[model samples]
Target: MKLTSYWLDTVPRFTGTPQAALPGQADAVIVGGGFSGLSAALRLRQLGASVVVLERDRVIGEASGRNGGHVNNGLAGSFTDACAKLGEDTATRLYKVLNSAVDTVETITRENGIDCDFTRCGKLKVGNRQAHEAALQTDYARLTVAADPEACLLDETQVREELGSDLFSSGLLYPKSARMHMGRFGIGLANAVLHAGGLIFENTPMTGMKRTGNSFEMTTPQGKILAKSVLMATGISRNAPAWFRQRIMPVGSFIVATEPMDEAAMRRIMPGGRNVVTMQNIHNYFRATADHRLIFGGRASFSRSRTTTDITSGNMLLAAMRRTLPELPDVKIDYCWGGDVDMTVDRLPHAGQWNGVFYTMGYSGHGTQMSVYMGQRMAEAMAGMPDTNPLAGRAWQKIPCYGLASHFLPLVGAFYRAKDFVQEMKE
Candidate 1:
């Protein structure tokens, strides 16, 4: 099997702006060229700002192109828990913004004529345990009443009809959720940024940043640049300030894409063509690609993503996939890969100005839509627009002993696995 992202392998490569001398100054300098950076660059240009984006690797080479391809709406964790922790009104607002985030992605795709196979396939949160059936129903009731009227609860018969697997007991359906070809979207957004007046430099990493009165001076290997405003769209950066790094934990998520399956089998497994996520502590999320390939992924491990780790995690995911869906047609794995998720303690995204630098990140694992949405909003906010940030005033606490995440993550993983085992046994 190829050890690369199926999304990136299938789409046309983005040949960014020609290698040239870096501009001396720009109105705004974006520190990362992932979805958030590209989205912000596009919007900033639209707002008549001279924008420059510096990417350490190829555009969209990281988490943006290496995700499960679900542009799902709503909170990544329990909405009920979010309400209790963030207060009902705040949680509801945060949930609604995610719905808006999905719409923003769709709008950008349509407006830019990005043929990324964007589809409102909706999302199905499957419950894997007998107890989860009632819990999911309760979540559905709470979600529909507070945040999403487009959501519905699925009973056992109805859930089974939507899924080919018998493992799921019930489901929560969010019709506003969508999926798209992430590679195509990333390339399209980059092209849109170029089509506008923005400048993007690939293979350029911002190694240093100094606040020069009224402007920030950024140093890269290519050259130095000055910007009146800076947006740290960098997610889980290896070179980020210690303060930023402490609040964000980089967790590895692995995925595997099956060879194109029979259309009949595909329909059987995913009749509704919905993004599927199971209700487990270390749950899996999956969706069928436009070409009928099953793109399955999960937090196979909490370790950082690398070549060896990716292979090990990919094997774990394939095994889990087989167990989760016995009805899946026999097919070889076409692609396997992993990426680091910018996880926060609260499992929510935070965006606002820090000191003098504007930043957005900490999406945890549910960043696909929020990253893009926050990028645009941050750009607009930088352009002196009204604050549309939902996560603006939330205190971002540093992860305790953040430096030792690697040593402890495996233990945490073990504990979660035991918890899941006990839960399954009870069922």
Candidate 2:
């Protein structure tokens, strides 16, 4: 099995335009060449702003390409709990924003004619424990009444039909949730930005950024760019800016892909071809690729290294998958990879500026859709329409003791694992 991202390995990397060269100045400068940065750059170009995107490595090769290929809409937490925490009106607004993100992704793919196999295949959220059955039911009831009209709670009969495993007691389905080849989408989005007259520079990491009299000066390893506006789309990488270090915690998420499954096994396992996610604090998410390969991933390890620790987590995922589907006992594993997710204390995405830089991040494992939509919204905000962004004025609190590194991650993981074990024992 190749220890790499199936998405990044499969798609052509976007290395900017022909004869890609760094430019000196632009109307707007964006750091991080992932979906968020490229999408924002595309929108900025549409608004006739001269834009440039800077990437530290291969475009979208980080968490963007390393994700589980889910464009699933909704919040990280349950809608009912979200309403209680964020208030009814605010939570509802946030829910709609996530829904709008799905639309934005579809619109970009359609309008730009990105052939990334974008499909509205829906999402299947299942309960890991008996308690989660009631949890899904409660969430579904609240959802159907207000947020998602198409969401429905699945009983045991329906659950058995949807999932091969009888371990789950109940499930919830969101029809609006979609899936896509994220690597292709990233390349397509980057190309769209270039076609719209934006410059992208890969392998260029921003070393320093400072506001200098009505413009921002961004210094990179290769060259520097002076811009009237700056967008900090860079996530939890090693070179994260000093100011952003305190606000975001870098968490490790891992994935492993199984070799192509037989047609019979594929049909029997995930017949509906939906993104399947476990309803656990430390959850497992799996889906079938168009090529009939199974991509299963989760927060298997707290360590963020791409090697050793990543391989260890991949083995854990393989064991988990085998336990879930004994039918795939002999299936050969083909790929494995890891990426860093920007998690916030509140588990909600934050946008708006700190100092003079406009930014958006902290998706907390729910980024694909929100990142795409918020990029356009931030573009509109930069164009003098702050009302377009619902998360614009949201407060961003720094994680306590998360200044640069998460030293207590091991303790945190242990606590959650123990809690989950207790819940399982109770059931």
Candidate 3:
């Protein structure tokens, strides 16, 4: 199996602006060329601002292209807990923001004519335990009245109709969830930035940046540039400014894709044709590609993604997939890869201006749609428009003892695994 992202391999590699020179000055300079940066660049240009994007690697080579391909709506964690912690009104508003995020992604793809197979296939959050089934019921009832009226709870019989596996007892369905060809969308977004008079410099890393009067001077190996405004769209970046780095934790998320199976077989495995996420502490999320490849992903380990770590995590995921879906005994695994998630302590996205720099990140794992939506909002705010940022004014604290956090991930992983085991045993 190739240790590379299947999404990135299937689409054309992004070749940035033809012969575009690094300008000495721009109205806005975006750090990181992932979904957030690219979306911001596109909107910035539309607002008549000269924008420049600096990417440490190839465009979309990071978490943007290395995901489970679910443009799902709703909160990343327990909606009931979010309501308690953030207040019901705040939680409802944020949940609607996510619904709007999906709309934003669809709108962008349609307006740009990006043929990325965008589809509103919805999502199913399945539970394996009876306790989990009860929790799903409670959450579904709360959401239908408080935030999402479109959500529905699936009984065990309904769950069996949707999922082929006998593991799931019930599920909660969110009809607004969608999926897309991430690679195609990323490359298309980059091309849109170029066509919109924005400049994208691939393989360019912003090594340093400091304020110069009202403008910010950013340094790179190739050259330096001055920008009146800057956006730190960098997610879990080791090279980011210290203040931003301390607040975000980079957690490893890994995935494996099976070779294209027969369409009939794929349909049998996922008759409902929806994105599936398990209700576990160390959860797994999966979906089938347009070509019938099963892309299954999860927190295989707490360690960061590396050459060796990816292979080990891929193997773990393969084993888990087999246990979950017994029909895949002879299927070949075509791709295995991993990426780091910008996880926050609260598991919510934070976006606003820091000091003088505009910033947005900490999506945890539910970012595919929010990243694009927030990017556009950040762009509008940068252009002197009213701040429609839903996450504005939310306090962002540094992770406790974050300096030594990576050393403790294994312990955290072990604890969660044990907790899952005990919970299962109780049933």
Residue-level lDDT of model 1, residues 1-427, one tens digit each, is 9999999999999998876578999999999999999999999999999999999998999899999999999988878888889898988998999999999999999999999999999999999787888887778788888888889989878988898888887889989999999999999999999999799999999999999999999999998999999999899898988889999988888899999998999998888789999988888999999889999999785554364787788789889999998888788898999888998888888899887999999989898899999999999988889866767888898888889976788889989989999989988
Q: After superposing candidate 3 on the true structure, give the runs of residues whose Cα lies further than 4 Å from its correct spot.
A: 303-305
User: What local lDDT does model 1 show for residue 112?
Assistant: 97
**Looking at candidate 2, what is the lDDT of residue 61?**
81
- Scored by TM-score, the top model is 3
Clashing pairs in 2: none
The stretch of ten residues in a row with the least summed lDDT in candidate 3 is: 301-310
Question: Model 2 misses residue 168 by how many Å?
Answer: 0.7
Q: Please report, in order, the local distance difference test score of every candidate based on alpha carbons.
A: 0.90, 0.85, 0.92
Cα error, residue 29 of model 3, in Å, equals 0.4
- TM-score per model over all chains: 0.98, 0.96, 0.98
Ranking by lDDT: 3, 1, 2
RMSD per model, one decimal: 1.2, 1.5, 1.0
Model 2 poorest 10 in a row by lDDT = 301-310
lDDT at 79, model 3? 85
